[model samples]
Every structure is written in structure tokens, then in C-alpha cells.
Target: MSPTIRSLVIPVTDLAAAKAVYTALLGAPHTDESYYVGYNVDGFEVSLNPSGDTAGPVAFADVDDLDAARESLLAAGATEQSAPRKVAPEARVCVLADGDGNPIGLRGR
Candidate 1:
């Protein structure tokens, strides 16, 4: 199994239209809301957000220990982009910028 989230959060302008296209490819979403839509494709997550950031896709890595993972990445030269935020009852997420400033997300319990 992949240790990473295998998750991609795409920014879209037209949520409805984008949802249509993605739904056709990945089928129904498990979590559908106006701001975000999420689908699980064989354990891989493909999420869509209709925010006009235009920053492109962000990938998240699933970690058992978010704090440890964040510390490890920080020690390895990654800079924190966003602090951990709880999105669900069992999930929390944060973003870190790699050497090139690319966003890397960490998701965990």
C-alpha cells in the first residue's frame, strides 16, 4: 500500500462543471459539499476545491504521526507553509514547502 495520501486537491473555478468531469472519471464522491468534493478511488483520494487560488494541485501524504513527520521534514529543510488544521473528527492536515517552495501536505489523525 502507498504510505502517502495519494491525494490530490485541485483548485477549480467552476465547481459544478469540474465535479461533472471528475465524477465521470472517478464515479460518485463520498463527501460532496459546495466548497469541496472528495472521492476515494481504490484508496487514493482525489479532492476538489472551488477556491480561486489558481495555485494548481497539492498532494498530501498520509502519516501515522503528523507531529513526528512534520518535525522530520522540518529537520530535513522543509519550511512550514501552513499549520495543522483539523478537518474531520479523525483527521488533521498541514502543508510544508519543499526546497523549491512546492507545497507538500501531511495528513494524519
Candidate 2:
């Protein structure tokens, strides 16, 4: 299954500050903003989640076959963090970390 980037979530301590930076970086006013803001850009979605802890980004994607995708990653030297699990009617996903410990997600509807 060929995967495509779906969303990128950035945890932020100050939503307004982060929004300003990202808005300028993207060079466009936010497409959507609320207490929880979401931006749909270039077939990739950007979202900001508020938190007090240090921020980090999470990359999400679409996969035709999540199970097969996970297997392929393992074969290619990725370590599984969580086995695939259903998220109910909406979708399913699995978690893995590459050799460098960056998270990689496998997801399907």
C-alpha cells in the first residue's frame, strides 16, 4: 500500500503564538481556527493541539492496507510500538518507531 500524508499535528503551549508563526510560515491566514485550530493545505492537514508540556509534531497518513504496511515497516528495520488496533467504525492504526526513534504511523479506514 502506498501511503500519503494526511495530517500533521503540532502540540503547542501557546496556541495564538504558534498560530501566528505557522500562519506566516504558510504565508496564508488560517483556513480554519477555533480553540482547536485546523488548516487544510495542499492535501495535507495541519492541526494544533493545546498542551502545557513541551511541544512536538505528529505525522499522520493514509494507507490502503495497514496490516501489510506495518509488516513491511518491520521488515525494513522499524520497531513496532503498538500492534494495529481498531479505532471502531472510523479507522484503525498501528504505531512504530524508525531506527532513529522517530514515530511512524500506519492507518486505514
Top lDDT prediction, candidate number: 1
Question: Which 10-residue span in candidate 1 carries the lowest summed lDDT?
Answer: 1-10
Q: Write the per-residue lDDT of candidate 2 for residues 1-109, one digit (tens) a residue.
A: 4588797767788888888888777755455555456776886778776752222576867898787788888999999866787854878866788898787866785
- The residue-level lDDT of candidate 2 at 100 comes to 84
Give lDDT tens digits, candidate 1, residues 1-109: 3447679888899999999999999999999999889999988899998974537788989998889899999999999977988988998888899899998888997
lDDT of model 1, residue 35:
85
Give me the runs in candidate 1 sitting further than 4 Å from their true place: 52-54
Q: For residue 26, what is the lDDT in candidate 2?
A: 73
- Residue 106 of model 1: what lDDT? 89
